[model samples]
Target: MYNSQEIVSISNRNIPSLITLPAELVYSILDNLDMLTILISFCNVCKRLKNITNTYHRYKTFTILNLTHHRINEQEFECLVNTLQNNKTLIEIHLRCNKIDNQKTKSLTDVLKTNTILTTLVLSNNTISTDGAQYLANLLNNNKTLKELDLGWNQITSEGIRYIADALNNNHTLTILNLQINNLGNQGTQYLTNALENNRTLMTLILSNNCIDYEGAQYLANMLCKNKTLTTLILSDNRIGSQGVKYLANALYNNKTLTKLHLRLNRINSDGAKYLADALHNNNTLTELHLGWNDIGNQGVQYLSNALYNNHTLHILHLQYNKIDCIGAQYIADALQKNTTLRELYLACNKIKNQGAQYLLNILKNNQTLTTINIQSNKIDFHEIQYLIDILEKQRIQF
Candidate 1:
């Protein structure tokens, strides 16, 4: 006897009670919904559904940047803010490459001030300049929940980094910070390095593609000698050559926590490699080292090979596109025979011909640890490929 619209309303009203769904189940369903869809569908539901959807577990991980590069806009972001403002359950928000400006950053920070649950925030590749970054740094000074932050590829310079460094001294929860590709130069690196001497929570840092030269690198090296929590440091493409790299190698001799160091595409040559080899001989923690795209030829490889005889922690070494020929490949292969830890090696696009390939084959035949070797685009022949594949198959069977 009821009208169609009336009946629809009654059914919608009774849907929650009729289902007898638990609160946890409702949360799980909302958690699987995308940000935009969560806003649309959950908001359209009854007040109870809206309340349940606003909980922390429902929309905790907001990944604005997926691999496809479909970034969010300001209005949509604001819609998100408005939807979650009173919810107090959001935890992580990733806003990579969304073209956000200072105004939006300010607005976002204002909302973040009330957001007690958000512990991880990533705003990489968004041109958030010094002022914009400072706004977030200010939030960090008081934010208790934020434990990880990434502001890489922003326009934040030395002055902005100083603000962040000041916050880092007192901020205990933050463990990982990425300032890579930012304009944080010598003065900025100096500030950060000095503060790191006092700070203990920060465990990993990426400063690649920044304008940090010998002075900046030396300052960081000094800090590395003292800092205990930091394990990974990336300084690739920084032009920190022999002089700077020697200081870093000296620091590595003393630093116990650092396990990975990336120095790719720098001007680090045979001289720098010698310094690093000396450090590797004594250092026990460093497990991965990337020195690719440098002019570290046969001489450099020889020094590194000698270190490999003593170094047990290094499991992966990348030496791709470094002008290494069969001579350099032979030196590396000799090292592989002694190195039981090295499992993966990259010698791609180095003009390595049959001679070099044969040397690598010999290493693979003896070295049980070497599993994945990239000899792609080299001057390798069919015989070399067959031999390498056979070795890999044999290893797979053993594993």
Candidate 2:
């Protein structure tokens, strides 16, 4: 009994000193610690940190999955949702890899309806179906605080996309929406295009690797012609072949808001390239155009050179992995004498030889705006490499 009383006296002496430390310092110590372990271990520690009976903001960002990557049950999910709802300072919630279904969606919606300060919500790799998507859309329509919503790698089909489109029609605060790798096909793309046509708040939309083909390209291109809000449009790895390329080219002739366009891995051959080159002469807002890994060869290069004479808005042009030889290089070099806005030009991995490298060197001799030129992984000889290196060294010295 004497020994027990002595131990209790020592423990009582330590309690006051632990509490005497500043609250800010205590919170800062917890902040620097790894959040995943801290959140899981806090409940096991003494009552001060573990007691949700005291304050709610002790847990800001919830990651229910412990270090072992086990599934967090519905009860634990509800606890996290309630804790986040009670704490207004919660800014980011990452529920990645958790199999969240419709029932979980309701619990999440309840929390979202009350939480007004959340800015970034990541629900990737979850099993939220059409019903859950509809619930999320309803919550997003009125909530204006969220800025980024990532639903990538989810099996959200056309039905879910429709709900998202309806939500995007009125939700003006959201800036970045990433829905890549999802099975949103032509039907879903049409709904998204409709939303984009009327919604003017979104600035970046990434729809790569989603199997959206020529018809879907036309749907988005028609919207791009009139939307006047979107700046970056990524359509790589899609089957936007010759016809789709022409459709986008025609839209580019009048659309003045889009600045960057990614058309890599698309079957845009010389004929389609000619149409796009013609549009480049009239379009003035586009700054970056990526046409890598396509079939646009020497004929396409010649056509693009014709547009380069008058085009002044394009600053970066990527033409890697095309069958452009010395003849195509000469055409671009001739235009480089007069065209002035282009700064970065990527011609790597093309089957260009020493003659083509010499033509490019001649262009670099007189061109003023060219900054970084990538001619790597090509079949150029020693003489051509020496000449290009010498030119670059002389230009650096002058600058």
Candidate 3:
């Protein structure tokens, strides 16, 4: 419809410029271009290109880099460490289940000295040796930004824990530390808890599956008496028997900061429950107690139930797989009628039959604070509990 010259002029305006391309495509083009071309030759020629360059630079500033299960070896991880040297915005580095070992731990930890914003470094489930913990210890000694360091499921032994304990003695910024399932025997726990005596910043310390018994627990109890900062302590899957709980319970009588204590599968029996109950009677800060799977029979529940009548701070209690029968269910039901603070009670995998279910049903009608109750695997028929569930709000009961 137009002349050749007029049509050619209109086509010139319709031609797509590099700035009009897709964002990813433009970024790819910039990645291939040199600095001089980006700054002087190409980007300066277009106003939209400058805006794209700003986005390009912003996209590269990674704050939370999660390269989990990437199998990144020492050589590949060295490049990441080099990038972190200049990355001030990065706060968390999760290289969990990577191929990191003890040989090149220096390059990995050396860059942390220059980084000021990184707060969490999770390197759990790695092959880092006991020797590698020395480098981590060095980082923790002077680094100020790191708050939580998870070195769980590694091969760090007693000697390695000694290195970390020495660092804790001087470090002040780190708060949450996880050293679980590392074969840190009582000797290693002794070294770590001894360091905790001087530490002022740490709040949560997890030492689950560390082969710790009463001797290691004694060290922690001793530290808790003097250290008033720690709140949550998890000692699950260890060999801490009745004596270990006794040692910790003795500390709880005076420790005003501790709120949650997890001692599941630690071989605690009726005697251990009595020790904990005695402490609960005097301690006012503890809110959650996990003591599942330790064969604490009806007698143990009686002890805990008796304490609950006076304990007003506890909100959650886990007693699953503790051999609790109908008698134990009655004990808990009686306590809930008077106690008004508890919200969740996990009693799964017990021997609570239809009679036990009825006891809980009668109490749930009157108890307003108790919201969640897990009675799964308690050998009770659904029909036995459904009639009660129909009367009250069924949302609180988990069969």
The residue pairs that clash in candidate 2, if any, are: none
Cα lDDT of model 2 by residue, 211-309, tens digit: 888899899888987797899888887888878888889999889789999999888899978988999989999999999999999999999989999
Best by TM-score: 3
When sorted by lDDT, best at the front, the candidate numbers are 3, 1, 2
Clashes of each: 1, 0, 0
| Model 1 Cα lDDT, one tens digit per residue, 100-182 | 77777887787776667777788888878878878887788877788879898888999888888988988888888999998
TM-score of 1: 0.85
Off by over 4 Å in 3: 1-61
State model 2's lDDT.
Answer: 0.78
For model 2, the stretches where C-alpha displacement exceeds 4 angstroms are 1-32, 38-82, 88-109, 125-128, 382-384, 393-399
Which window of 10 residues has the lowest lDDT sum in candidate 2?
61-70
